[model samples]
Target: MSEFRDSGTFQGERMPKRPNIVWFLAIGATLTGVAMPMGTPAIAVSAITSHPNQKSDPPSDRIAAAMRAYLRDLAAKEQFTGTALVVRRGEVLVRAAAGAADAEEDIPNRPDTVFRIASVTKQFTSMLVLKLRDRGLLGLEDRVCPYLIPGYIRTCPQAWRPITIREILTHTSGIPDIQQLPGFYIKLSQPTTTRELIQRFVNKPLDFKPGTSWKYSNSGYILAGAIIQAVTRKPYGTVLHEEITGPLSLRHTGYSRRNPPAGYAKGYFTVGSPAPPINGSQAFSATGIYANADDIVRWDRSFGAHTVAPPATVKQAFTPQAPCPSNGCLNLPSSAYAFGWLVDRLHGHRLRYHPGLLQGYAASNMYLPDDDIAVVVLSNVEETDTNGIARHLATMALKSASAHDH
Candidate 1:
């Protein structure tokens, strides 16, 4: 079983800042790709710190070149071994991969190489559940107990307010994270049924009451997946494949365990060795999906196309849920997560994205609606700082679009 962390809670989360390049870019009115070493940390430093004016735009070619240069630098420094893509209005600005898919075999990583996308799978789960709700198969306000196995919820009758689907989707459900429980990693690798899975975790009292506050819990999604199965009488992977992936012809997206395919870029905890494989059954819908950067960009654009869910419903998922009336929302300046997405701003443009981290893989996908831009980064190597790189790419793409629009 995979021991999953709330991928939303990544360390080194950063806030917006201005860098020395602002005046340089605004006054110079051009960007020439830096002649810095590929392994230099300077590009990442500037990308993170150099804030720009919303109106101040730079050349498209210059911005793209700088973005590539930044990734090249990152690949050298981090020894990154996956693909990175930045797309706007269906145009790919940057697509690059580095390092080895299987180092012992000396196979180089390619843009098409598949990697387990980890908790980024939550976004797909949220979309699937919301789509069901949109079609009247389920209700966000509906109590979860009816769908979950009987006698399972009896253990926590006092805490179970029939946890609403909305609560589960928003991570506001009072459910405690099963992964935090004792012997979680040991339990993770064992084969367990969905009913048994819920029973194992549902006995504890909720961390907080439903709809009252926010705490990221994979268990809530675990329940949501159960609800989907109970309502549709289909396997979780089957639902995703038929409803979402099939509709889009997303040739590269699905659960890594249930539907094993060839060409998987071996995920590695150590640079030279493979991470121990966990039972996919234990991960379920919470954190057990995989895909490539190219396939993910299609999933990102599903927001605009409304291919899977209606625009209104997808918009609701993007909108941040209301916070506790008494405590107020957490005072986070850098970004906030609503549903499955990280909603933030880049140089005054709106960005909605999600990051997923697993034992040997790291992935992040970003989309800027106002700018019509999307960024995808997936790596077989851990601590790739996928989201950070994706964000920097967004910054460069927006800069290019801004210059073009002006």
Candidate 2:
């Protein structure tokens, strides 16, 4: 529950003139391996900062080294305990892991270590909805209640009859967050069916009329999962694989398997103890997916190439749909909720990102679409500031690249 609230907001003041590496370090991971796939052409470093041709591209190794040192320091301090990957224009600039994935077992985190990505799952769920719309199977403006499968939800609450698919996607549906409900934590320990989870919030009155206000509610995504199930006549997980991960060949990204996969990172609390266990099904469409840095990089590429959906649909997913105040929902100043992603400006860059937290795991997936930079930080340590680290890395990447241009 803390993850949902803690993941997206960036608390640092405005960007400084240059990379304040030390200062950012105070704000924020390991040195692992760096890969530059063969035959991959070098991206113009100048383009990253939107500065036209000036000089030749700089070696990415320098930036990677800086990032490695930064992460190594964090891990030593027990601030970050997982993996971090930064990609610029399809090139892996930084791929590193710090701290332990399973401390008791002496397992170190790696670039391929899978962590429960929590609400980062929301973006994928939103993509699923967009794909459905692309196939003409549904419309974003369609009423949500009509699509609730009778087998699962006997009746849609009267108050829910007016909500729209678009509203849910944008977190403007006003359904109370499932975590806000009584005994939600206890419920996480128990295996619950999607319908059962829906029932917990279905009878509750709307926090506000759908689309009239904005709120971060897993209930909205839960309803989304139900709606997807209703229309596809397949389980949400099945549909997710068939539509997104399968198509992308995202080898390590999807709902948790009955048995944890190889490289699975065990989560932990900040106090160096094991975090409470959670039933993956309980998180469902909102926070159930697991993926490593490599898989996430590929997922990010799909967006840049417009391969997941038609270019128009992808554009809509990134476009601002609902205004969120700095102190409200996401605590991101001048931010707007765009489908499952949050949109904001960082030093004039078009930044699109989502953060996820569930018990011991925290994840931050950020993209500077304009600059073609993607930063993914996944940690098993609960409450870690992966978002701040991501923003700092992004700024550093841009600044470092720009320096080379000069």
Candidate 3:
């Protein structure tokens, strides 16, 4: 269970400024009349203090100091075992790592340590879908069956011949959850491609009609990744690197297939006994992206500054598409899954968030648009409450930011 507490109430602060690179791209794209696919927002430049070294602490370091103390307490309590990054506008406000990157090796966690992002990778896949739509290569309204392998609709009585890209993006395609698949957890040891995985279960019946309701389906995002491949004739990793990671200089982020970086945490499942390390290759498009807290802060800044996709596209991704049967809308107290994010409200702040879980890894990333704050938590323990840790830290960060603003 996650615990979130906002100790003090304060007015919202101004949105932070974008880096020069973001401004240059935005202006260049605007001048060329080329749509800047970046969806980051522009805030007042005062939110961030300029410095020669990007790693240098900000001018008002109260937030960072508070966060560090909080993290130290959390680590001492065994409540967190990963890196946490809190940034406002484009400045690195609080960047701290706790616990161990490699628990067995006794290596201390660092801000640059990479962990498997798990379902957080969905956002990247969703971004690719939006990019394709912007380029006219695809449409949210387009049917999925036409682009997918044949007989995809054979198993679903309610499923029409096709599912839309929009349906898949919003998890309304009525596809069965990946957890429901037979031997899904056990099959992680085997090498499986996106095509093979889809072929194995594409004919399965739909849980509901496309777009009628929302359900969290990893299969839909996997299919979305496959769609990227089918249209671009390139691997999903290549597309992700060229389109998103490379441009942003997210050097620590990647879809690792074989060897991962040194000091990386090993994934483990505490089944009957502790399970062995899970490889990144097992996750493929559905998960598999590796990154650290600092890199994700860069990602959030890009979103906050409108540096990647246009603001309109980013809005579409965050906006609730179809109603969730239980909640009736994406606006709920706890996190409600958006296209690639878990949409929610905290202390009157709107958030776009997502959490990732694998055999031995857990992660969470969230963007609070109201306060221009983004929090990312990455852990090695498989079933650890990463979201809870993120929320706790986020609450603290927001409180500190509010105090600083006053």
Candidate 4:
């Protein structure tokens, strides 16, 4: 919300269209050699640590000038409109924002500006599910149907009856996304309950049989949220608060079922377009959270510092769980997925990440465990290349971090 650069702005070529992997893919890899839940080993697990005041993120002069200029160039073209941040270990290497929070009010984006994290919210949901698993309240491999008191109610042509929680996390459950279902917008025009949202698609048949295939499904997460509620006997939001946010003190993060919390960014399909309305009830644990760049970094660090779970389970979620097989998997190296994260290798380094998109928000939260770096990006403009920006900045930071190694 303050000045990025008042003297002059630099111009670089606009960000190119990388492969269109934005929201179409599942969660991905990180930690090339850290240990996760299943006895898998990733190398850099020893380096993941955080101090009590890891919030100090002074911009590092070590970051290349071109990287900073590139973000500025994208903003100058009205292509970028939110916050981007890079944290290596516990230090902030790059922190910047471009464009307005409310274009009508001419609010500038800032380091602390909140944005709808969209599907990145899934990572949190996944974490909550894992926490329950660790406590022996539920098993990850258990069938989801038994947890639902109302049962799996969907009208799709398939007579499928069983889908495991693991299958849901890996996008192999074959449940069709409730949002893409024919009458999603009508059913989602206003607030609704998790059970009500699931009811709308309860009778739908399976898009694909569970566990044999993979496809992104928001309804699968709705089912997951329902499972959480059924087990805890509390609302998903309440559980998220008690189990996750409250412990972490993530003051800026929430389930965001009604109006976006005070001081959050107003999303737009285009720069001059009016803000779009959201049905938070429809999103639930799948995509109903709002957060700032700083809180997101804290979330990342928590996972690294073993604040979330034992090392092995953390690695399991970050570990690549499914195959790419080009079934609409975005073109990437080893483009497999995991629990609410995409676990893949880019440039021979393990990367765990997820990209989220909503009506007017685009977000990507990525961690490169081999490099001990995490990138958090939130953009209000729907069309902005937030995922690309995160990828490019992480690549640049890795390069810089590599250069300093000598």
Candidate 5:
């Protein structure tokens, strides 16, 4: 812990208004294209291979300067805090950080600074489930209750019996969101087991009949985590490493259950003001993962290189499973939901993305398959619109690449 500073530009017009806790913590996405399982050796290389005839990114100096200055502007206005990484055709365009990771200690943000990834964890959790499915250990349509790990000595609620793994993965299972439950804040403040957390919300009636409607539910993913544990007989974190991160050599990414790991960013509400605290375990499989910008970029590349799964299988996860109506879903209006991503078109190009929010942290991960561009923005400031930042950067990158092609 470090001393909190009271005096700064955060006191001026630069300070952001606190966002509604419910909406801010909603951490959510959609998309379809491919599905893959982890079995082959991970592609641990730093550079992704460019596709044949893939357009080159705009001149490095121009795009890099444009992105760097844009990030700096956001930081100067206290609008952003954390790191951003952009890659085009497997080449690095901009890897930059703005604001402080540990404001009290005056530690500046860096590309390698780790932050809790919140709902972005859903993708990893979904991947684990899909890999299990590929192994014939479980089916996407399997009832979640049957595979759930029996923690807290609790039985599956009658209501959950009809919930399938696919419904949960697509956020259409109708299991009420755990964050929206009574005493959710209090419950998350204390360290608890997944079963204990589930016990609190298990009895709640379904918001809608399974598969009939869409609602973002962390509880559904928690149940997904439980199923993973039951089937693999391994903890979620253990399986995450054994199957995904370890094989990919993504040393900086893993599940952190209670405290920020070494070199991790200290979350903030504003410059110098510490963010509220919550037990990481409360998020469990829904949002307990953490990673640096570099690791996320590497993870994205794995999908493109088919290092994580077969091409056809990889396409399964990215295919839209649930449609987002005109009102929009997550942060993007009218985007459809895929396994762990949101599917929409960015300037007519297929875009798969997700945004995550947790106490004192925000993250956006977007991949434009057509452009082969990956833009990740991770912020330690709560309520910061990292998704917006990431989208803006992605669009900018795409435009630059398009310009170069012409």
Candidate 6:
């Protein structure tokens, strides 16, 4: 055993000590008293080489650390207050929560915090329509007017009366945006039945001939939701819960108007001196889906796994049906409308993405099928650039994958 002792030196002066001698009978020479000086060069050498200081990070960990640091800096600079998640082939690569869920309470956002998904809910409504088609209970080719209330398409031009479910899913039904109709917003605040909602727009005129052009009309999706209700004999929300959210075990996802979960971010719009909170009602089917980043990822994965719709049906949802004209599309450089998703190209990679913006909440979800990458961003701020953040995260996740490949 080796033992160490501290030897103090005063002004570089060495202290002396007495030595002892030992005699051996068989040895020719006697063991004489010998003085071995302590704190010599050998002791100093061992102390210097004992344990060298070094960093603990491996190369992969170092890269991940740098990426996290950059994300933190970017979030702070951009004033991003949301949760971001990145998953590759069903494996979570990164799940980070930043900023406050409720700014007033100073509660930091968490993975399970839910927010109104806004237009992202349209995808779920579209999926329900496609599922019904797969079950042979409905046909996309059937004219929607016949199944709906009488005069449902009377306001549309005579040429557009033959609009089909496929046309509505593809946003080519030529129905006007409900928000643009007079009294639509006011009526949205009220508990209007699906039939009443349809009747209100029955006499409205179409913007163009059906299937001749692409125009995103919320009324078209609401009509689809109503059709789901009519076919299933259940509320739209209940169908969504049973068909989509339930089988996936998405506990944090739901359409609720009563008490929401704790730590939920209050939606805010910057209008007056201080932005007022926006609490959306439960009646809106074209837009209302309350979920978090984690839940959204699960929802996206359901497509790849064919958990909600068949693989072919899911494929149709991400395939561009028609080119979107101005005033109805987001103007993505390489994007077009599919069943509900926006099919586009990002950095030469196919992307299925969508953004949801309501009164005080904004959310975005993106999936790169070729690379099996998906990302979701959920924010409470109505005007936040959440699409930009989602793009950045997707880029980072892809970059991480490329680096791993090398």
How many residue pairs clash (N, CA or C atoms closer than 3 angstroms) in each of the candidate models, in the order given? 4, 2, 19, 31, 22, 1
Candidate 5 residue spans exceeding 4 A from truth? 1-58, 149-153
Candidate 2's C-alpha runs over 4 A off are 1-59, 257-262, 404-406
The candidate, 2 or 4, that scores higher on lDDT is 2
**Model 4 per-residue lDDT tens digits across residues 1-406:** 1222211111211222211111100012222222111111212112323334434222334363456667767776777778776777555555566666766655555556678898898898888888889888899889777787554343422344577888887788887788787767665547777767877666777877788877778877887888888888888889988988787767677885786566577888887675566767777888888887767877787776777678987887787778766743444334787788877776778888888888888899988876778888898888887878888888887876766665
The digit string of per-residue lDDT tens for model 5 on 168-223 reads: 99999898998898888766668888878888778888899998988888988888
| Model 1: residues with Cα > 4 Å off, grouped in runs | 1-58, 151-156, 187-190, 256-259, 322-335
lDDT (tens digit, per residue) of candidate 2 on 1-406? 0001111111212222221112111000111122222122222221234224333345555676587677767766777777787877655666655656666665555456678899999999999999898888999999887787576678877888888999988888888999889988887866888888988988888889888888889988988888888889998879988998888777677785242465477888773688877678888888888887767767776776876788898898899999886574477544788888888777888888998888888999998877777899999888788888998898877876566457
TM-score against native, each model: 0.80, 0.84, 0.79, 0.82, 0.84, 0.77
Mark the 10 consecutive residues where model 4 has the least summed lDDT: 18-27
lDDT of 3 at 124: 89
TM-score of 1: 0.80
Using alpha carbons, what is the TM-score of model 3? 0.79
Report lDDT (Cα) of residue 317, candidate 2.
Answer: 87
lDDT for each residue of candidate 6 in 1-406, tens digit (9 for 90 to 100):
1212223111111112210110001101111111111121112112332223433323334344454555566555544556666666554444544555554444445444567788898888888898888888799898886666542333444645698998887788888877677875455444545666666666678888888888778888878887887788787778888988898766667765342455466666631112443333423567866776666777787776777777898898888887865533676544578877887777788888888876667788898878777888887777777788788778777776677667
lDDT of each: 0.68, 0.73, 0.65, 0.69, 0.73, 0.64
User: How do the residues 132-152 of candidate 1 rate in per-residue lDDT, one tens digit apiece?
Assistant: 987789888988887774623
Error of 6 at 302 (Å): 2.1
Q: Tell me how far the alpha carbon of residue 220 in candidate 3 is from the true structure, in angstroms, after superposition.
A: 0.4
Worst 10 residues of 1 by lDDT: 17-26
Candidate 6 collision pairs: 268-360
